[model samples]
Target: MTFTGVVPKRRLGPGGPEVPVFALGSWNTWDRMAPPERRALMGRAVEVGAAFFDVAYYNMGPHAEASRTDLLFGETLRELGLARTDYQLCGKLWLWEYPEAGFAEQMRVSLDRIGAGRGGPESFETVVVGDFMGEIDIAQVVRDVQAEIDRGSFASWGVNNWPAEALQLALDTAAAERLTPPSFAQLKYGLVRRSMAEGEFYGGWCADGTLALQASDSFEGGILVGKLAPARKIGADVGGIRERIVAAYPEVERVATDFGATPAQLGLAFCLANPATANVLFGASRVAQLDDNLGAIGVLERVGPDAIRAATAGLWLDRDVRADGVWAP
Candidate 1:
């Protein structure tokens, strides 16, 4: 289906930039696929208006030394001859250490790799602190991010994989200091894992319109697609989160079948059905997968919210499935 005119747009936050509701995420696929193949996929997405892209600095696969996805994105955009304004690009600086001295350098490296030209912060629409795993020095990180924004690296900033309380703290700190507060929060939110969606941070954001939630891992690492592991085993051996999600596959499939949709379609639809979901960031390893996910945009209206919730009623584990959480491998 052509998304040129049908896909919807939502503001990044209350007053943030408006982005397409359905955005493409580059994780294991962009660097793994050949340049031309990945280029074709990006082209297809852009042509269909699902061009808002989510990329990170850490996902170049196991063998890579540095990020290749950013470079590949630049190559594809250049090959397609798309102008800077044609699409929106979001990048994440992955830092595990409390204070990485090379924050600005890392931003420069990613920006240069993308080769989108030096229009200051115009090179990136949004950049985020990617997946901080340990105790974070809130004020220090906020100051560092603000310096980058002052230096014109990105227009806005957000956080990924941080606890809901921590996210709220950062937001509160930003308000107290009168600095640029995080405009978004990207965490694992889907039909199978409803902990974050049900948490205080999400609730506060919804109430005050302070932070936008970017829902990731909507497929529960593919278990929500109804593609069970060999022998139909559902446990840590398959995937920590998969085990939790696999248990609900039968019911998810039945509901999807009733609506003439595949389990994958229903999975994506479930993410979109969330009113708090600003964007559902998903990864695709193939052109077919990308196209299939794009079809989810049309499911929201057809299936409606009640049916989507009914279809996924018993799926929520009431536990956070984020990496290193109770479901981590």
Candidate 2:
């Protein structure tokens, strides 16, 4: 529970747990790490108080469904003999196929799948539930999740990749019903993809202190860090700007060198520099990468956030990719 020198802890929302500014995410990347390496990486995380984890369950995604991260994580935890209290967890309640799977059923089944009931964190500290592309009854979403919270399934909830309008409706709906509003908003946030979190709509909520910003996919599947030809599966290219992102790598590197930081450190610092970012979630498959990425904390202190943003302002990479109708599977 004793976190290292990551200054300024932020609370997730009202009644939510305060957490470190960075979190470890395992989407399709967990299995690639061998048992010994995974144990070492997690152990380091614990030692440094960087144990906040994003373990979103993949009930229905092409790339993520194929990735058995929950199974792998549970197996690894048992191997390391880590108790439930060793780390804080943020789970996801997928709305990709809502009603058919509902929040209650999803929580029970997925937590069991993750080995929670038998021997894991019994309930997540928080859960993010969104991705409402089509017709979504926001009231029902809140009601169902409220029920789950009462059942001790999760302490608080948040939105994920949801439109600003939908997120507002959820907040409004929760207020009207005297229920719990979402604590945070998880989005495709990073250097290249800043439209959602920093743009007018979502930014307004963040500015007004309505929702905490939890950034994900900040590395663009390693493309931003020079993994231009990643052989493994990555998250959805919401804007289909993989080439543009890859091309920007040199610029990223140049700016990083100028700042006396590595590209990866600079990227993490950029996300962390934003006052709204409660945490930046990234996937690292190696212990060295884990340690290296933590150097971003120093980058934020040395070069600072505004200078980093100004340095990369010419990139012109802040457009909304989904709204532009440019998507790649």
Candidate 3:
């Protein structure tokens, strides 16, 4: 399928300007494969108009063991001769360490992987603090993020997987301190999952001029892909994700049939269909997988109001009311 003409773009947030509808997710792809495989996938994603790539310092494993993934991502982009400005790069701070200094080092390590060392120019325009996981001190995290910005390490910063209240608190603290508030927030949203997008998180951020970047928008572990059947044992590789999905959405099969689109495509489109979602993050393991997902941008554009309503109805298992809530059945 040749994607002719330009892929449509949407604003990063109100008054934040526009970016491509689909963004490439590097978490599983970078961790599960070797450098060459990851590089090829990155190139293919770029060809299909997946101009944004999401990376994080701890994407590989616990601690910094997987830092190489980010390095390989940059190397591949450079090898493809794509100008840094031609693509948008978004990465996160692992935040495993607390206090401002440890957090600062985490950002520094992330920048180094993306080729933005002390004197080098930054290839990334956006940096996010990961998960928050309801554990970190929101105020301190915000302060550390601002320190990086002050040093010219990043242009913008935001939160990921944080609850609506936590996000508001961070924004409020930044206001009191006169620091730069986050410009984006990353959350999970898909055909079966709408609460985060439709609930307080979306409303709060939208009102605050912050963009919502939807990660795992496809409902990671392939629940939205319809590959794993209820009562069946998932392969050892994806067992953890599979178990979570089966537990949460026992009726996934019934819901999958209603969408007409494959689980993967529907999941991707669900996020794209929302006007509030700035971009949908897709995880592809191979070049072919990347190509297949890029087609979703077209599928999303074709989705009308009825399709969205039908897909959301009876598809979601649960909804998170709090900003830092986790939705595992």
Taken over the whole model, the C-alpha lDDT of each candidate is 0.69, 0.79, 0.61
The TM-score of predicted model 1 comes to 0.86
Cα RMSD to the true fold for all candidates: 4.0, 2.8, 4.6
CA error at residue 120 for candidate 2, angstroms = 1.6
Model 1: lowest-lDDT 10 consecutive positions: 230-239
TM-score of every candidate relative to the true structure: 0.86, 0.93, 0.80
Per-candidate clash tally: 0, 0, 5
lDDT of 1 by residue, 93-138 (tens): 7656446535787677677777736332245678768555566677
In model 1, which regions exceed 4 Å deviation?
1-4, 59-67, 116-122, 230-241, 319-329
Q: What is the TM-score (0 to 1) of candidate 2?
A: 0.93
lDDT of 3 by residue, 42-79 (tens): 76666656678787665422434444666666666666
Q: Which pairs of residues collide in candidate 1?
A: none
Alpha carbon lDDT at 13, candidate 2: 57
Q: Assess candidate 1 and give its lDDT.
A: 0.69
Off by over 4 Å in 2: 1-8, 61-66, 320-329
lDDT, candidate 2, 192-249, per-residue tens: 8887787787777776788888888898889888888888877787766777888889
TM-score-best of 1 and 3? 1
lDDT (C-alpha) at residue 139 in model 1: 75
